[model samples]
Target: MGDTGESQIKSGQGYPVLKPVGDSAICIEFGDEINDRVNDLVYSAADALNARSPSWLRELVPTYRSLLVHYDALAADYDEVRSDLLGLAASDSAAETSSSGGARQVFELPTVYGGEFGPDLDAVASHAGLDSEDVVRIHSSIAYRVYMIGFAPGFPYLGGMDQSIATPRLATPRTRVPAGSVGIAESQTGVYPAASPGGWQLIGQTPVQLFDAQAQPPSVLQPGHFVKFVPVDESEFQRIQAEVANGQYRVAHSEFAS
Candidate 1:
């Protein structure tokens, strides 16, 4: 949103270190906070660099406060890759582009908020100092921003949570958090794209599969998209779940092109 020019500003040593995760991947870290400003800048540069990535580049992974850009050591040396990363870090121009703005998608996630579907719903309500219905309303009120997709395939790291509804993770992690398990942790809320072991505070679950390996994009949602959880009754949840089980769920796409 400001000047998009290269700056020699350096993240102090031990602050935002660029280290090699593996033989081919290098991570560029920003800081510790998961604020809007930090994630926005990171995703902006990532989108721009990804749009015109070099031939040696393999994959670009964006996290809350860092970016993992994997490249070939044979075709491109570390120095060359570092130099490219420096340019990306310095330039603010990419963040100013129209495409860099909030690329939000409004998703109507049909969820079953209580009962077995949401075991921690009552706990969350107690922790938030509100009734169960109030908790559900507050949780579903905001249009959450998809910070980054990681942890599991198509798992969107959502932000813009109502602090009133914010709660810590479960003391003991669950063995199996089914796909579509909507949960909140710290100041963020997200869905379990696939069945996985997790510790987030479960509040509800959606019927749609966030990911499908057979689909073109695989994920129904992506980073920079917006999500709005729409609470539905048990019957509707069963109906949608049945559709997904039978491969009849109508997956919606975001208006990202505009």
Candidate 2:
């Protein structure tokens, strides 16, 4: 099965490939590589499907280069659904939307870097041949794209970290990483929405409640959105933490041209 799947992907030639997952899900793969263009296609396809509002459509999961579509097996035929997806993938609107620069939500998260909150800051600075301050400056300089949310609930897989500050994961995984902890593993950086065992090098921590089970959308960060980290002092961190606890903290955000 692995060999067949590899060969099929190899022969795709930049076209979307519909691969069945179990009996109810279809993975529409745009390409094998991960990039903004490929991710844009995934988002466009998801938007198109959502706008169509097919009765059998159950869920849409967008990733770096593909869209995992779940449908009601009992209500829809596999062949028909496959054909519909192909049409949608080739539609003019999908292509135009993917290329057009649309406004995207950019969430600004307040973070406290170094000290107890970021235990591995010194290690990362040493690895990068720079001071801890430089690492923080470079990290907070750009807006990172939320490629996908996986590994754990509301655990964002972010992209666009400056390569100079990139650091490797810890030799040993931590048993419990505090929730809202931001870490860098290789080229990627993300926040730990919930406390979980992880190996990523902890660099900073945010006070934002990334995941709230009672909220309408449990995950504050969604795929395709942008995240900007705003560095704050220890006192500000404590203040924001208090506001978050009291349900008074509103996450600062804006719509920017993507």
Local distance difference test, per candidate?
0.79, 0.87
- Candidate 2, position 17, lDDT: 85
TM-scores, all candidates, are 0.84, 0.92
Candidate 2: the clashing residue pairs are none
- Give the number of the best model, judged by lDDT: 2
After TM-score superposition, what is the CA distance of residue 143 in candidate 2 from its true location, in Å? 0.3
Model 2 local distance difference test score: 0.87
Best by TM-score: 2
Model 1, 1-258: lDDT tens digits are 112222213322344457878778888877556655556666776777787678879988888778888999898888888887777666746554655554456777888897889899999999988999998998778777788998789989888788888899999999999888999887778999888999998889999988989997888887767788888999988898899999988855455532
Candidate 2's residue-wise lDDT over 108-160, tens digit each? 99999998999999999999999999999999998898889998889899988
